[model samples]
Target: MEFGAVSDEMEVKAPAAEAWKVYSTLQLAKLVVEMRPDLVEKFEVVEGDGGVGTILKLSFPASTPVFTYSKEKFTVVDEEKRVKEAEVIEGGYLNLGFTLFRVRFEIIEKDEITCITKTTIEYEVKEESAANASFVSTQTFVEIMNAVATYLTTKQL
Candidate 1:
């Protein structure tokens, strides 16, 4: 198997707590679907309630050339540390021969009124299908972060 990881961070003009309120819950998925319909076509909760063990299904627009849907389960949700992790259990990269695909979000406190949104993608693919790893990128997460930051800052105004 081949393992790979990518991460990116964005400075947000909002408190860590405020950012956590969205990142730690399904609100982030909702925001992404609402803000980027071209990227996410639908968001649905398959099980649990926005917490650890929760499963979410995301559908991509038809224009997307890759997988159409993905199901991810929340493996970790740490409010104290402001970190959350979701592992893709089906579809998405898994269909492309990836053995594991996980996304992690960290909201770090920069100050009383500012915070950093860190996003990471970690994956393992079979050596025979290592080429599929190229599809993994942090660009989508960066776009989501931008939308969330813009929403949070605007709401604070």
Candidate 2:
């Protein structure tokens, strides 16, 4: 197996607690789908709440060349650290030979009124399908960060 990871960070003009309120709950998922309908067709809750063990089924538009849907379970939700991790349990990268695919979001405080949204993508793929690892990218996370930051900043005003 081959493991790979990629990360990206975005600075937001909002408090860490404010950012965590969204990242640590299903609000972030709903915001993403509402803000970017072109990227996500649907966001459904399969089980659990917004805490650890929560399962989310995300569907992409038919125009998406890759897999149309993915089921991810929140494996980690550390309120103190303002970190959340979700692991893809079905579809998505799994169908592409990836044995593991996890996305981690960390809200780090920069100051009382500034914070950084860090996103990390970790995946393991069969050695023969190592080429599939290239599909993993932090671009989508960056987009989410942008949307969230804009939403939070405007909502505060």
Q: Tens digit of lDDT per residue, candidate 1, span 37-107?
A: 88889988999999999999999999989899999999999999999999999999999999999999999
State the TM-score for model 2: 0.98
What local lDDT score does residue 31 receive in model 1, on the 0 to 100 scale?
95
Evaluate residue 69 in candidate 1 and report its C-alpha lDDT on the 0 to 100 scale.
Answer: 98
Clashing pairs in 2: none
Report RMSD (Å) for each prediction in the order shown: 0.6, 0.7
Candidate 1 lDDT at 38 equals 83
